[model samples]
Target: MGSPVGLWVCLWHLSLLLLSWVGSAASGDCKGQRTVLRTFPGFVSDGPGNYSVNGNCEWLIEAPNSNYRVLLRFLFMDTECTYDYLFVYDGDSYSDRLLASLSGSSLPPTLEATSGKVPRTGHG
Candidate 1:
């Protein structure tokens, strides 16, 4: 039988391959669509193509009424570490509670607003 170390390495490489495939498959452009941000309980993406250098983008997700909270998920993400960032705010604007400040290629876990009418998401 193969050595335990060899088996572990093989499994590691396989996992990386699977992750790459998933990211590419789910990757796509926003297609200049505004409704993706406006619609409730929808998806958010930076698109398949690489984002512009030194560019800033933001989306404000809000519930249909004040009684609801916003939920967010990151299907795939590959931003420049340290240079680029994705910021999530718990309230309607940047002045509100900071929920998460995420970066890197790994997919982050789901995020939910504690108590806010609007949850703002920004990337730069």
Candidate 2:
């Protein structure tokens, strides 16, 4: 068996490595990160280019006008539908309305906000 001091040193190093990894994942450069939004006319994505790997990100489109609804357009989309997806909600929260779930190589149709009279604004 390893000596007690050696084992302790290994555990300490492992713990530090884990902490840094968690921090990096939480870093701005990581994918599938979490965020909350209270305003509209915004955009979100899995990262810079075509999603290179499995990742996820939720988007909420909400406007305070109440009369205004969210609009969305999928300019570019090619994902592993069976393993990855992009979910859209009509309101400020996930429980609001499941607008759509986009994945695969197909481009989703243009979407206009269902409620409100404000000019349509979309994000992807």
Candidate 3:
């Protein structure tokens, strides 16, 4: 026979272990990462190089033939960088669309990057 307090402690430990396992499994699902569209045809040039210090680049699609925006963030670098503008492709050529950009001078030690998509209209 075990004491009530001991049983309670065992139950708490089991719960913690289960929660940890679930968290690990959820993180494992994110093994394969997606690529961001750095360049396109019709759209203009967004910038020169990978401006993001640490974080990865991502493509944000809003609406087809409508306005779209790219969400970028910096990671653990102290370099001051600017997103400047965005460019969209039209199969053949690319046009430069000037817009506001996100910049970060410094970032924390642990920074994770993620991207999401939005459905757009008029796009083929």
State TM-scores per candidate. 0.64, 0.52, 0.20
Candidate 3 regions with alpha-carbon error over 4 angstroms:
1-56, 64-94, 105-124
Per-residue lDDT of candidate 2, residues 22-87 (tens digit) = 211211222444454334333443444444444444333334555444456554565665665566
Candidate 1: pairs in clash: 28-47, 28-48, 29-47, 29-48
Model 1 C-alpha lDDT per residue in residues 52-75, reported as the tens digit of each score: 666555555655444455656665
Question: Candidate 2 or 3, higher TM-score?
Answer: 2
Best-first order by lDDT: 1, 2, 3
Clashes of 3: 17
Q: In model 1, where do residues sit more than 4 Å from their true spots?
A: 1-36, 116-123
Model 2 lDDT on a 0 to 1 scale? 0.41
lDDT of 3 by residue, 3-26 (tens): 433221110000100112221111
Name the lDDT value of residue 92 in candidate 3: 17
